[model samples]
Target: MEKMILNYKEEELIGKIASVDTGTAIAFIPDDKKMSELQINQLIAVNSPRAGTHIIGMVVKMSRRLDETILQNDIDDKKNDDNVVLPSNAIKLVFVGELRDKEGIKVNVFKRNVTALPNIQSSCFRIDGDKLTKLMECISTIAANAVTPLSLGKYFIDENSTAYIDGDKLFQRHAAIVGSTGSGKSYCVAKLIEQMAELKSVNAVLFDIHGEYSDESFKRDGITQLKIAAPNDLETANKLDKGILMVPYWLLNYEEMQALLLDRSDSNAPNQAMQLSKQIMTAKKSIVKGTEYESKITLDSPIAYDLNAVLQELHKLDTAKEQGARGEKAGPFNGKLTRFNQRLENKMSDKRVGFMFSLTNEEQELDWLQKFCRQLMGTSKFNNGGIKVIDFSEVPSDILPLVIGLVARIIFSVQQWSAKEKRHPIALLCDEAHLYVEQNESIDAVSAIGLKSFERIAKEGRKYGVSLVIISQRPCEVNKTVLSQCNNFISLRLTNVEDQNTIKRLLPDNLGNIADNLALLDIGEAIVVGDATLLPSRIKVEEPKIKPQSNTVQFWQVWGKNDSTQDLDTAVENIIKQSKSE
Candidate 1:
């Protein structure tokens, strides 16, 4: 093969080697020509006695110039060009080598010759300058061939595109979106979901806590929107076509029951809950068989136990103090009582004593308790509704844990039932997850029944088709075990050192530059990584067009403006009139 060569005036020589650095070398090219940055992998001929060969190295850095002298002969020849201006003596040229050692010795230690100079030629394509664009083109090609219904518009295909998600691997498994507040975490999440939802074969269940995703907004294209709410409109509520939320008490495993029932000090809570569950099952079987008992039971049966029934039984067991033969009490019964049956019988007659035997007896107050159990057990329209959003904003703080735990238990139990083939995969979005998972008090139940269950699904549910999307402002507070199970990660602007470190550890080494750019990211730009993408990527996320109305107080305008006396009186009168109307 003939050697490829081109002749150019020596005045075109840009620079000579200034200093040799590890993995790269630097040369100060005079700005007289004002040439653009050189691309990596550009070959330059180096004249050396030991190796008079054309060497090539990729350009890793393009900005800095080092202090070194060039050969006077190369500079003198290049001075003919009007743009060529020599600073002092010579030009600096940096050579990139393929192999540094020759005959088991380093070559840079002794090699010295100066017959040739480094010059830019229009030969080989530069890898550093074009890699990003090449990758984007590859992605665009794959997306164009996608059989899935979603589309990638032309706007994301431009040459300057620095950020893009690998669209091929997204359907392989579930994904996660995590970040601190204002990290554009939500925007990334919405964009991905929007794309997925456009695909006809993909069915997504999004749990929107803030009611950010509504029917009106997500209705474009071929996607359908379903909203679940508490049964407020009694007439049409039952007939409404929506999914149900129900969890049978019998479905809760031993650990879940313990988390649901046992107090902190009860070391045997786990065992006790398990044993009690067995007893309840046995009792339920006996009641179904119509077994004879001392108490005259007709419509009410304690064996018809659910979560409410279990709670009632626990209350009875606690209150029935045993008393000695005369008036001494021993067990939960306050007065003279020895056994649970006797106390229950004694309370049956007196209205004030309260009926303990009947499961739904008002005296036992178990009737009121049955509502929650019925909600979980009965196939009532309210219970089996799709995507119920429980707005606990008005609920008292003391009972919040119980409410969350109860709901979580119900959801888990319901999902456990549907046959694997018939089961509809559900995605539970836990917003402010740190509040539930990190709390020292009243968290064990939710932790065991909710967080642990979700974590298991995160790891194993892709095959089973169940998924979880956990959102949190404080990543440090999230359980590491749970966080590690997440296959996909959408990281937003995180200023916290600990949080950044946590994310850095999860991301691959190739994304180091992308991670460094996190601090300067815009409000809706995020770095997405993990299984759902081909490689780590930075993407600009689109905002939701419509969302639930928020009650943000306009304190500045309200307080800063002068309040008119007439307006104040009118507002007070309107408030009083509204109160009277209620």
Candidate 2:
């Protein structure tokens, strides 16, 4: 006689394991009524010989195949028959983990790795209703024992119980949240932020590419909001309103500046880049002339320098003539520096980038970098959570990658250089990551440089207490390098075949069926998998108290309203200004 599980009952019997593979098992259901109730993603248990232990699997595929002999007879007769035959239901399950009762203890423990596969003819039971609720609660306790769990929402299988993820594992290992438009991607992110905000010293930075997260969303007691200085905010730029942001040009290293101002397509680009490098070093040296850093500053140092002085020297080089054997010969850089000069002038004069080129005198102080670091990493009354939401809505698409990468690099560098004892961990929530972190066949010099910075972070940021939360709608468009580095994934509905395929490729070979219904997921429903989760589970994310401003528009409701003509002219003017919604 088989020793029954603690809660095992005859009524709980669903079927028997017909076959067992490395990562999946096929269960045969003889009862039509029992088969009807079986649903995809539902959890089931297969009894093992070990006491208080069972193999856990999730339903991934279900089908009813007609008896071949019966079907062949009707086909051969080519005539209608009155007899009816019930088809056998085949339930395919993806093995997730092994659930066992700890020795001498009543508690059940769930391990992601399976120690044994179910043998053929093993009895399988449906773990729904009360069974499922109890199982999830037990798993939640297991998660809590390892580390503080992050309560994202409720499990799809057991809505009565909350879904918990290992918070430490989730961040220590990078994470990715992906879904289609209107699939509640932003809502999930907002909810996570809301939870982190509850901590006394939360440290995170959300790269708000479209200004999606609003003040209302983060109006919580420990959250802070900040916006980048737009074109219109230039004249009044200051830290007073806690509204201004300065990504000073001096902060960019030689390679970053080259990406911003050097056009490699030009035949003379090489010569020009060389000249620009020298001039930057000259300007940096000039700034530290009488300071202690005079002997220590490198060309890539983040020290303040006069852009005008560099431009003046470049102008002289472009017009200088050298006395040679051929009397009054043009300088080697005379004609080569013209185009480079124009590019630099345009970037410096562009009002849209005032945040980089135009900064207050205070922002140029030697200790400004220290203050900036504190603002981003400190949890003081003036700065909430050390959580900064930097809005990049007005940033141009062409330079978006470089600018965002700059900020990430700064954060990583600060943490890297800090003394290990004094280092504080920080998480970067990159919204709209695909726009800047995509893999491409051909890329411009600037984008190549930007890509390098992010790739480095993805590969090594973990060692320095820096983590990334890559958020995107199109997983296919995101860089595989970054995606591969992530050990946790929160995937919502994805309708595109290509997008679905991308997620499938990342998942383990045995769990391919697990992502088969990605396109069919309900809004806010997601399959949470990887290191953070105790077991691969489907979750229905809870709605945030204050919604993000980027929620999908109700097209039907808006179509019912008429547009106002009074503001039409102003709207057109704003569009032309390139600062319309700034």
Residue-pair clashes per candidate: 33, 0
Pairs clashing in candidate 2?
A: none
Q: Candidate 2: lDDT of 383?
A: 82
User: How well does model 1 score by local distance difference test?
Assistant: 0.44
lDDT, candidate 2, 1-582, per-residue tens: 322233677877889887666777767887888999988888889887676788899887776766645433433434322233322577777888877866455557677888888888899998877677878887887666653457878988788888888888899999999999999999999889877777767788898988878457575576677777677766674473465677889999998998888887899888888888898898888888998887897888898888888999999999899999979999878877898898889988987788889777867788888888777666644585567887888788888888888888999999999999988888999998998888786877767777777888899999999999999999999999999899898999999999899888998887777788799899999999889897788899999876788778777977777973357777787767756544
Candidate 2, superposed: residue stretches over 4 Å from native:
1-6, 65-88, 104-106, 144-149, 380-382, 561-566, 580-582
User: How many residue pairs clash in model 2?
Assistant: 0
